[model samples]
Target: MTYPRTRGLPTTRRTGQAPRAGTGSGFLFVMATLSCVIALAGTYYFFVRTTTGQYIDESALVEAATLNGPAERASTQFLDWLPVISVVIAAVVVLFVTIMRRRWKAAGIALVACVAANLATQLLKDWFPDRPFRGVQTIELNSLPSGHTTLAASAAAAVFLVVSPRWRPLAGFLGGTFAVAAGVSTLVNQWHRPADVVAAFLVVGAVMLPAGWLVLRTGNRWNVQDGRGDHWASSRLWALLSAMAGIASAAVAVYSLIRIAPGFGQENSTTNYFWAGVSLIVIAGYLATVAATWLFGVSARRRHAL
Candidate 1:
């Protein structure tokens, strides 16, 4: 069945009118500035005071770090490989936005946002330079804003702009999970305090959300087609397949986690197995949903061509 494309209410665009300043770009700029200011202010508060003003604290970090050998190893592995995963996720968002929305502007804006966030984090770190590692007591430089969290949030915003609105909830959930994991890992590893992680989340969110909103608004104005037509069977099938793949990947990841860190739970060996099984099943369902949607789009296109 042919599905009618939904169009938004038309707005006037005069030739002499300055090209509509990208809402996403403008919003990103504002957020980046705000995050930088906050990071700087927090750094000053921690360093400038005569007495050691602990602006951020991570009491739980000590507990998290004292995990059993297996759990500690697992966490280490997760942290070590996190940067690679983040880069891959970012690449996916850029590619999806470029292909689906045909919005080079939005992609560029997202890239800029990522860069700005990273720079801001780095600058803040430099400003609040942590003392050289002198054992557990050594305080590290300004770790107020987490670079990993920033990357995750920016990437998530980019993906949200490219994907259909129906997928927003899933995108947001995945993004939030990544951001939280980044923050938690840093805290547990004693690389950053809890306040730093919290600040990072707030800073990233403040920038990303507005940037995404702008991208959506500007993208709507451009009249770009995402190529995913509403062919019920095809769409459903694609979503199912994509979701299945995602689930499978997630399962593999979880299994690897368990194998690498078997001592995570109590002596009851069955608990780990149970949780792994549950995780696999849940991830599989999510993957299946995504696969079905993607496959359905492919099917629709093929049929249209025929």
Candidate 2:
């Protein structure tokens, strides 16, 4: 079956030369992946290895546990199943898109990204040295990038990548929300800290951005879809909402951090840091989603131009 190509991408004008759809997208993907790697390393250094970061992370864990009760217990019961649910949903979505659109290349790219992201998470967890006894009584082994968060984020990202551009903004918004929730739930359960979740977001982005560009580079025709005023999922409203939510969360986190700065190490209350960490996770997740959606959209347009 011949896959319908998007008219937006340009082919050879007269000489019938092979398409160069990958040119601009290839550069963008490289830059984006490098940026994510830098972000991940920086997060590991500042949050996982440093004294201040450990204090804050430990404090948040304490606060999160304290905040955990009947409501939290109920939440964990459901959250524990998120990885399985995410995998199932992502598998169904990826298979459907691959079969319906006959986008075998896209399917393979998504699968590779998912596996690479998760594998990277586990490797980082084991390879990174334990944190020095930073005056904080906590486990020494580094848990900077969380496994569960990676699972959720990568799965959600795979689905986002497989879907047509028209559906991405909505998928990004909803998928970001799900991933963030799963990250935050880990916090509530005292399984991982906020920075861990944030790092997970970066890892998934690092892996997915390149994979997404590959899809655009290979499946350009099927990847590009009419997004303007098409469906609710394709609307700009979702993008706007995601941006608003990210901005708001960042502002709140800054304010919380400022308030806690005065008593940074001496404070007994975990409330401020807990919320602040959660805010950072929210900001990272939504912003990454928005960036991914925008990258694919721009890459598609540029491919058409080439």
Q: Which candidate number maximizes lDDT?
A: 2
Specify the highest-TM-score model's number: 2
lDDT of 1 at 60: 35
Model 1: per-residue Cα lDDT over 1-306, one tens digit each: 333332442222332221232322443445544754565466446433323334113223343445457655665677787878877887877787688868786777667776666676667667765534422343555565667655655555556445544454355446545665565566555565545655555555445545554554455444223344453422344344445555665766466446536385343332333333224323423432343233323322322232
lDDT of 2 by residue, 1-306 (tens): 333343544344443333455666777789889999999999888877789878888888888877847858966886779878888989999999999888888899999999999999999889889888878899887887899999999999999988877788888999999898889888988889888998999999888988888777777465544435467777878888889999999898887788787665434455888888889889888888788878877876555444
Give the runs in model 1 whose Cα sits over 4 Å from its true position: 1-58, 129-140, 221-306
RMSD of each: 11.7, 3.8
Model 1 lDDT-worst window of ten:
9-18
User: On a 0 to 1 TM-score scale, where does candidate 2 land against the true structure?
Assistant: 0.90
lDDT of 1 at 189: 58
